[model samples]
Target: MTKLTKRDFIAGATATGAAICMPAIARAQAIVLRWADGQAMNHPSPQSAVKAGLEIKEKTGGRIDIQTFPAGQLGSSRDMVESVASGALTMVTEGAALLGQFVPQISIIEAPYIWRDPAHMTRALKSPLMDELNKVLGEKRGMRVIGVTYYGIRHLTSGSRAINSVEDMKGFKLRVPEVDTFRAMAEAWGAKPTPLNFSELYLALSQGAVDGQENPLPTIQSAKLAEVQKYLVLTGHIITPRLVIVNDAAWSKLTEADRAIVRSAIETASAWQDAEIVSQENSLADTLGKAGMTVLKPDLESFRKPVLATLPAKFESKWGKGLWDRIQGL
Candidate 1:
């Protein structure tokens, strides 16, 4: 090899410096991501999402800035998923129920009376079952699951009447998110299920378009459903886990380091959201009672067995055989 001259040495040093500065320059001109949520602005779902965005901005050194749109300012819940799937938006929040449409396996987690406690649910989610779901979503739907937040135990509230038993559910029209598991559960327990968007639920309830709707305790409080619906029946049908999703196309554009930062930020925020949910949900029943909504902790036994006896068999194909048993084992 020939000996290097001063000019060559100076040129090599300049190139090295430029390469070192490139990532920082790119960070300064970072991509702006839109993170959408259909829940109300003050709802913990959107609040947690905003925190995630802030964390990403900090952790990524301003390389990825996420902007949040809550309370369906962008559109309906389904609309947000479609937007992210098509890469029109960067992020979205979907409960396991909604995610079922995109990745059918996700719905199994929404099955009623499956988990004994929050710890059980969390363990199942961290197991291979969840790994399979991530694989299915990534491979089939081009969606990435960056975070999982606790959505709390969903209970039924009716504008029609107080339902203490499964027999009370007959001849009722229940508003369900457009998820098959919910529809199936409602039907099995003796109600006509009407699928509706989250943003439209309050109006539907108030207008008599649907007799009732089911949601987590925080959702009831945050959406102020107590204002219209009179009865809260703690059926505890679904303990939902909300997911923070990113468009795979947009995710692929990021550097590995940035992707890791995004994941960590979202996960940290997810934990915070879960804690917030536990805190908020603890007092929600009393709060609803004070809000003039009749809160009933009914004998869920009369309701649970009917659905368990039928819904699982019908839903098994969509959720994969043995999935329910696997979840229980977890």
Candidate 2:
């Protein structure tokens, strides 16, 4: 080896110093986004966000880093969305019902019996119609919805009596979210709708404060509702979808290529989450049955007729006339 001169030695030292500092510079320049959600860490949606965050970092070559906060770590779902809109938070996964307060038409996604099934729901949400709604949401609230994931279909659970028909719902005190659609759904079935905080539901059910409640099977399992509720009636009343929303300003800051990478990562994660939710929903009935709940597949048509007849008329004005039919056509 040739002996190095002072100039050569200085040059070598400068290159070594630059290489050592490169990673620290990249870390400092990386765009870190906080993605928050209300679901527990074990829940599919939150897990999906975690998966997307990893993929985003990998695909963006560490230029973008997503940090996920699950189970209301940041705040309640509504609060998180508000934070996103105000730019306090970078992103949030929220239900259409909560986002509906921004665009009333969007809330119809949670209307009872509107979607024929999950496939239909997925198609409608991905369709051009939703693009129009998304535009409206962005314009009205400065929030942009980038991805949608399947949250399980909502069903009824009873502590005392199995809901076999609409008649069976008469005088039934059903716990429902304070949302008007849910309250209207319970009333259409002839049940007395009790608006209560979801945090209080388990104790309420255990003590007979409410006769029945409705939620997706995965939620039922995750919340350990099988312990408090004795009967699972497959009314399949509502199909809920979670929206991956970001502040428009935050989304606009990314380069187009980075935006594409982030979107692709989220799409991949959502597909994985959808499959997991469907798998869990398919098995949950038996799982809950084994846990001492009687699982009943009630005549869904009986449940469907009343909801369609009453709900569409009640909601179509706000959701846009024919929006219900358009979604059903999906």
Candidate 3:
């Protein structure tokens, strides 16, 4: 007949616990996971990744603790990948294009126009082919892919002129990701591709080592490239997705419950990241324009032809016809 208030319930519960139980409970549940990335903490991708980690801790009742290191404080992407492989670091969120070096199958996703839309890409990710690719990485390469997050539609920024067509790219010295697919894409577009570390891109642009670079508008804005670059072309050449990866050694050490928790958390986080990128893409050009950069709307069809023409041959050779067909079917 007695009604218990919330405070009464807590007091009653605490009264049943031994004095030593609380500390033991805390000690048994505390888990610390380290996450490293090559972007600033405030950057959307890293921020989203950290938000996911925090959500995991909250949902798990503080049983999981995540320590985030951003802005290359831990190391470069290559170093982070190596650290994750060796179990020196717990996890990292990096561009899938970078994974092409370790798993060539990843290069197929880097091919231009691989997906007609973000929804298409998301669906393709859930396909059995993608599952097989992830399995291979975990079973053979010592890395476990948790989920994929979008970077956004990539565009061209330059110090010289507006890129209106493939012909406009001629003589442009463009900084590209240190990946063969990107290099090949830039070459196909008629630009001279220069491979540079993302960290070195700012200086490369400032010193005129490269006349331009391609990236999402948010990246161009976040890195303050507008201050040095004069033109912005909406090429949407590639829509890059970043992979959430953990070292197989680290992942294998976790209990199945913990692994499931980690996987679920990554999926939730990737969704948040993808939505954030879409929102950013919607507003990025306006923001860049306000920053004094000349924004040009180019004839995307002309650019698409060259990129698509090169894809079939390049992807078929690298990933084979079956996998490429499977992706196309998606």
Better of 1 and 3 by lDDT: 1
Report the candidate with higher lDDT, 1 versus 2. 2
lDDT score at residue 315, model 1, on the 0-100 scale: 82
Give Cα distance to truth, residue 251, candidate 1, Å: 1.0
Where in model 2 is the C-alpha error above 4 Å? 1-29
User: Please, what is the TM-score per model?
Assistant: 0.89, 0.86, 0.87
List model 1 lDDT by residue over 200-306, tens digit each. Answer: 99899999999999999999888889989999998887778888888998889889988888888788888888999999889989889998998888888888898
**Order of the predicted models by TM-score, top scorer first:** 1, 3, 2
Worst 10 residues of 3 by lDDT: 1-10
**What's the C-alpha lDDT at position 281 in model 1?**
86
Which regions of candidate 3 fall more than 4 Å away from where they truly are? 1-29
RMSD of 2: 10.6
Measured by TM-score, how close is model 1 to the native structure? Answer: 0.89
| Consecutive 10-residue window with the lowest summed lDDT within model 1 | 1-10
| Count of clashes in candidate 3 | 0
